[model samples]
Target: MSRPHSVVSQVPSGVLVVDKAPDMTSHDVVAIARRALGTKKIGHCGTLDPMATGLLMLVVERATKIQDLLMSEDKEYEGTLTLGVTTSTQDRQGEPLEEKEVRSFAPEEIDAAFGVFKGEFEQIPPMVSAIKKDGVPLYKLARKGQEVARDPRPVHVTKYEIRDIALPEVTFSVDCSKGFYVRTYAHDIGQHLGCGAHLSALRRVRSGKFTLERAVTIDMLKTAPREDLYKAMISLAEISLMRGA
Candidate 1:
């Protein structure tokens, strides 16, 4: 006869808000959480690019059921775009493809160009993205020196504001619907400005009702007491409340 599982091995069902560090993939966070929490029943609501950092919602145990619903919610991000440079990946990770002189522009000019991006528009998903083509992720093909034609995807940019600008670099925030790619947005803006551009940095600050303020870092999970770690978990009941919010 086999022995039943112990209570110590079974963690409570809930969501864990994580402050994902730069260079770590979403799956990397999930693997670390599995070991820290002592359970393999862990999953994430959305995938963040390795170069992007910030709030990542992880569903643990029975909380995994709501992953799809959570992923479908709108998201907010803040990042800096570097003007006068274009990259193959649309971000700093890729090799520089082109460079142009950064020309002077008024704040109003920048705002007017951004205004054109507001509301609904069609965007081509970046080749460095996880979007699949022919059963393989586009990034895989990108790594092999391959480029494929992709259809433009409709994306809604509810808000796009330039917070600050220092010539070659522009810092901005965006509130956009799911499936929107901020890297593509930056690329498009650069094209409109006639100077080219690429995403230099990105941080996801919000997802659905969850925010980075409530997230815990990997270091915290590693050093906190087991009881304290449990305290950080958001129960599924709490998540259900967000459905109406």
Candidate 2:
């Protein structure tokens, strides 16, 4: 008789939130988690571009069942954008395509530009993105210098607070729905102000009910003993309790 999958499984089910460091792909964190947790059934809630850092939630074992559901909720982030350049990827990781003189855009002017995107709108996904086209990732096409038409996706930004406005670099926090691209938000704001722009830095701070306060650092994930890692897990029961509340 064939054995059932869970009968042979050894790991518990829960969510593992990691404070992902900059320059690490979300999948790279997953690989480290898989090894640290000793299970191949782990999956992250969403992808965080390699250049961006912060909370990345991983679903383990049976928790993977709710991955898509968890991924569909709103998220919060803090990011910095430089107003003098536009990049191919809409972020710092891509090639710089254009540069402009960043004249002193007054705080009121900057606020007005950001105000244009305060609510729901259409956003064209950048070419250097993981979104697929005919079974190929757009980033692969972007690597070959190929461009393709992408439909505008509807996204909503519930809250955007400017934390600092230091001329060319603006730092801010935003609460936006799933699939909202902060890089694109910056680029469009630049376009509005006629200065061009690109995302210089980004850090995810929250996703739905989960926050970075409950996250483990990437270093701990890399070197912690398996038992220690298990203790860090947010049990499936806890997750249920969170969702119910």
Q: Rate the local accuracy (lDDT) of all candidates.
A: 0.89, 0.91
Model 2: per-residue lDDT, tens digit, 204-228?
9999999999899987887766777
How far residue 174's Cα lies from its native spot in candidate 2, in Å, is 0.6
TM-scores of all candidate predictions against the true structure: 0.94, 0.95
Tens-digit per-residue lDDT, 16-102, candidate 1 = 999999998999999978877878899998888999999999999998888888999999999999999999999998899999999
RMSD of 2: 4.8
Backbone collisions counted per model = 0, 0
Off by over 4 Å in 2: 1-9
